[model samples]
Target: MVKEYYDPEVKYMLWDDFQIRHIDDLKLKVKGYSDDECKEFDTTEDILQFYPNFKDFIEQFFAEEELVNSSTRLNYLSNYADTKTYSVVATEQLTGRLHVNENLFKPSPKVMEVLHNATYEDVYLYDLTREDELAVEISKREEISTDHILIHSGSSDVIKTVMSLVLNKGDTVLISAPSWNYYKSIVELKMAKAEYYDVVPGKNSYEFDVSGLMSKARAVSPRIIIITTPHNPTGAVISASDLETIIKENPSSLVIVDEAYLGFSEQKFDVRHLLAAYSNVVFSRTFSKLYGLAGIRVGYGLCAPMAKQVFRLDVNPFRVNNISRKMAVAALRDEKYYKGLLKDITESRNFFINEMNSISGVKAFDSAANFVFIHFSENTDVQALKDYLAQNGYLVRLWTEGSRLAMRVTLDRKETMEKVVALMKEFLEK
Candidate 1:
């Protein structure tokens, strides 16, 4: 190993102190055993990695040694999400003037101006706004009134925030499977039990498991019923009628719809209209997906009583920056641009499904968003293809031990994805 010369007075810092982002750290290095023979262990065997644990090694490499759930994370790009690389991200201009990448952040240009005009803002400072004020505005989501919209650390906040609206600790949350993974995890994180109803996979991709979903929500009377519209992984959009039936049956439970993928939705269902019909219903929206502001992180919730309670809590403020807010507002304002993007991505998704379905060993599902989920031949290690794609400058999400060869393909409208599909078929043929 080569050693670098350093000043004697310079102090050494621990990796954890700098707060390196997880993805960046992964780029610098990777984790694995040099010896493949002992790569895996039995129950007592698998836990033996604890001696030279895989998770620990991964965290250490990423300088997140204390982070939990290291090995369990699948590369999100390859999952249900449209990992369409951010094409419109902010670029530094020679004039030093800034232009927002509408694909990646929220709160649009207008929102940015509003935030900048306000006294309470400092992008570099990671500032906070008054909870009661900002959260209070979130309350005016529908005809009903609510004041709560507390910001939390992750998508899990959807649950914690909504629970504050409708659930007490230890409340039951009914969830439908083949939805976003974080939805399941968030409910459990909030000191609540989760009831899952598996949807029947149909001719198309992750179909809404309507009958099962309704049956279970009725039985549990869960305090919160979470549904994903234009769902992740499955790429299925829940019908308005099914949504109506859900609210009609679960009178006791609050219905929380997670519209994380709605920007990519073909038909925009105005669920907000339902808030007029049911006091027990709310919708959660995030800028992460359609606006492509996954990193900037501005999520909005629409509710009546639920939002009212969210504003009163002592949560962090200005969690979404002027930049993110600016971009989001841009996304909302540019329906033409957003619509054009939707058309391209929808076409890509359809093309992917048709092409992949033609392959003998592959099964592709109908998707409404910018990704296509494919089940590969039996024992197909989708990781092999993912690794190949990554090597080809493409990043994908991978699923382990699923019903099919599970991998998520992002929409770039570039030739790369087409070639990727072709290569995958070639690999299958081999």
Candidate 2:
């Protein structure tokens, strides 16, 4: 006797590498699903693709040689301990008590004075009821059509809210293949189906199966379309020409562009340029990858004015939390830190690609994001390669199939890069 709506839990985007697979985000329970930690860290204690704990791999590589000294180990542990204070989860919990002498909650003075003088009613305990002040601030900052940046507990909350606002049930969604592999999971839960397209892999490497996508878009009654840039699993960006074509053709479908890794790109292409051109485009961005805000869960979606009505109707209140928003605000202001990381990523990405190109059995995939993908020679010993290299003190990503050697390496410092390359060269030689 009750009407059932699309569940957003099934709509959350997924990352296949270095996440907890079997367990829920609260990290409590496990379902009977089969996949290594490659899909998620809640997954098995397999290898870490991102911040890989490669110390064991290091020790084994030089087992016949001298071990890292106790003093050195202590120094490394000391650095790790020092890092505890800066963790996003820890900071979020400790934020309210944090010293505001530094002006943490201080919005632009012009912005703050207005809030200070305004009549405050309870909307998430932040001037939410102020007739026009908070409304204008959020509208300008978030591009919300009416008012309020939706408060969300996590990516799942955002996804579910979007679904309720837009589709009724069984509206077709189009996605590309060889993605993070969780689009199917989200769709299955909402009774939505995705027609997947393919990306042609090779040099002049910025190509997607646009015709395949267009055909599917027309054939199915597609209500939504999603694509990623600095693409996951593959780091290629959608070319400008192709993007224009896609936008022009998909008039009826509300296109969702997940620019999760846009921060990792060398050139910045604001989806705003496209969103301004087409009212049908929706831009989703996350603080997960480059911001190191993944665990604390801060993500935002930019939609055209018409779409915000549905989004506002669908989202929950104070889901973001005072601390997470503060941290997000902190990260945005701390462009200095991001700039330093960006430099490291650019250098590391180039090194990784050059190294991959040098390897005889490997074909490196073009990537503009933080990680790199590789296709290995047909006859290469994939598992043995991973195991042998593990003993040699480096752990690269191992794909499920045979004859493919691929790893998505994160950027650290210059010294770390030298060590990674040296170890990789040693393993490949053996």
Model 1, 216-256: lDDT tens digits are 77677788888877766666787888888888788888887
Using TM-score as the measure, the top candidate is: 1
Q: Please give the lDDT score at residue 154 for candidate 1.
A: 32
Q: Across residues 1-430, which tens digit of lDDT does each residue of candidate 2 receive?
A: 9788884543552322112232244343323322332343322223455447765775576563335454355554442331212111111112222111111222223323333444433224643444433234335554444332444544445655675466645778788766654554555446566677776576724357788888877888588777777676677788766776777788888777767777777745555467678888766666666766665676776666667667867665434554455556556666666777777777766776787678787776667776666666665555555544433333445444222344555444446556766765665666
Give the 10-residue window scoring lowest on summed lDDT in candidate 2. Answer: 84-93
Q: How much RMSD separates candidate 1 from the native structure? A: 10.5
Q: What is the overall TM-score of model 2 with all chains considered together?
A: 0.64
lDDT score, candidate 2, position 12: 55
Regions more than 4 Å wrong, model 1:
1-156, 311-314, 317-319, 400-405
lDDT score at residue 369, model 1, on the 0-100 scale: 68
